[model samples]
Target chain A: MNVTTVFINALAAVCLVFALIKDTTKTKQALKIAIISFFRIFPTVLAIIIIIGLLSGFVPESQISKIVGENAGFRGVLTVAFLGAILHIPSLISFPLAASLLEKGASITSVAVFITTLTMIGMVTLPLEIRILGKKLALLRNGLSFIIAIIIGLIIGVIL
Target chain B: MKKMSKEKQKKGLVKDMLFLGIILAIAIILLLIFPEKKELVISSSKGFFMEMILILPAVMILMGLFAVFVPNDVIVKYLGRSSGIKGIFLAILMGAFPTGPLYVAFPIAAALLKKGARISNIIAFLSAWACIKIPQELVELQFLGLKFMITRLLLTILFVIVMGIVIEQIVLLSEKTTKHEQTS
Candidate 1:
């Protein structure tokens, strides 16, 4: 296993042990939550894995880079950002999907913006957010996030 | 309401399964047609599947721990009292701990508003909840590596803080004008 894998698993194990020591019932409850969520998200994860496979098998690297690579420019970046904003993929799944694209030839900018928008703005949840948080704040948050997501993507592109 | 959500959950699961079925069918058909590419597709998919399976349980465990240990009331208690720069940081920090989906945070944010928390803090809390959860960051680190994850994270925090203040100012300005009109 890689360092990232080891570190995260270690962190989780340590936390669970401490939690178990302090409160057995609560720790069991946490593990229950973990199992439920894991099963809940499993099907979606499989779908994403298959899609990544299809992408590598069928799609050409040239096409991926042309659409989202460094030379794809501002318009290309915006397209991915907009796609990210609208698509309802789980944020966890989006990382692997994103990494697949990056490995193929996608720009750091496109991937960055895509992930940022995917996590930050949810078009599907807008109405509920508005009803709860009000129209102004909801709209402003989404709108501003769209902008900042691009900015963040561009900055990451420059840095890395 | 409870029945409706359970129904929705059932529908969501059905939809997810249906989607997976369709994609799986398509993959099988395509593989049968282009047998040469089967190895390539399976290898790539397996690579990602392995990468994801390794860390996801860990991520979920962390999420579960946060959900049970860090109560929402605790968030409301601290975020309701703080103000200024520290409040902004605290809001982000608190947001990072909780592991629910973003929609879950809206009601909490609304309650904090009613509790007289600063608008900026509430905004910061919501945005941070969206992008900066701890488990989510670890997944990003695993997939995207440290430099990409850290840089994007720092940038997100910076802009989220700015957006919070900007939106609060606009809301306050509009409130002031409305109050002026009422007085007039």
Candidate 2:
């Protein structure tokens, strides 16, 4: 396994062992929860795997870089930000997908914008947010987040 | 809540499986037409699949442990008591540790509001909960590398804090305007 994978897995294993040592019943419950989440997240993981496969296999590097690469400019970044807001993929799966996109020649700006908006905006859950946090707070948060996501993307693009 | 989400999970599962099936079918067809790409596709998918398999369970276990140990009430109680810069930091800290999805945080934020948590802190809490999640960040670090993950994390922290303070000001201004009109 890669260093990142090894480190993360070790962290989890250590935490699990500690939890188990503290209380067997709670640890069992945690494990059950883990299994459920594993299943819950499995489909998206599989879908991302397939999409990454197709993306790397089918889309030419030149085509990818041409559209979302360093030269794709502000419009490309905005397009991705909008899509991120609209799409409702789990943020965890989005990382792998983002990594693949980066590997496939997507610009750092677009990828950063995509992940930020995907996590922050939540177009799909807007109504629920409105219902809970009031129309004003929810709208303001989402709108302002969209702007900052773009700004953050640009800054990252510049810095990195 | 559990039952409703369970139902949603079932519906989502069916939709995703259907989606996956279609994609797999398309992949098969493409591979048949252009056999040369099959090797590329298989290797790419296999590499990502293995990487995910290694790390995802661990991430999930950590999340599960946090969910079990850190009850929502504890968060509500702690956030209800904090304010100012300290409060914003606490909000983010509490948010990053929580295991549930963003929607699950909405009601808690609302409760925090009713309990008189500052608007800035509540906004910070929600935003942090949405993005800076512990398990989620680990996945980002694993996939996007330490530099990408850390840079984005830092940027997000800075912006979320600014957003929280700005929203609080706007909300306060609006409330003040309404109160002035009422008094006049």
True contacts kept of each: 0.84, 0.82
Deviation in Å, model 1, residue A121 alpha carbon: 0.3
Docking class of 1: medium
Model 2, position A146: C-alpha lDDT score: 97
Which regions of candidate 1 fall more than 4 Å away from where they truly are? B1-3, B180-184
lDDT of 2 at B118: 93
Q: Give me candidate 2's TM-score against the actual structure.
A: 0.96
**What DockQ would you assign to candidate 2?**
0.66
lDDT of 1 by residue, A1-160 (tens): 8999999999999999999999999989999999988988999999999999999999999999999998889999999999999999989899999999999999999999999999999999999998888888899899999999999999999999
Q: For model 1, what is the alpha-carbon lDDT of residue A38?
A: 94
TM-score of chain A of each: 0.99, 0.95
RMSD (Å) of each candidate, 1 decimal: 2.2, 2.3
In model 2, how large is the Cα lDDT of residue B133?
A: 94
Off by over 4 Å in 2: B180-184
TM-score of 1: 0.97
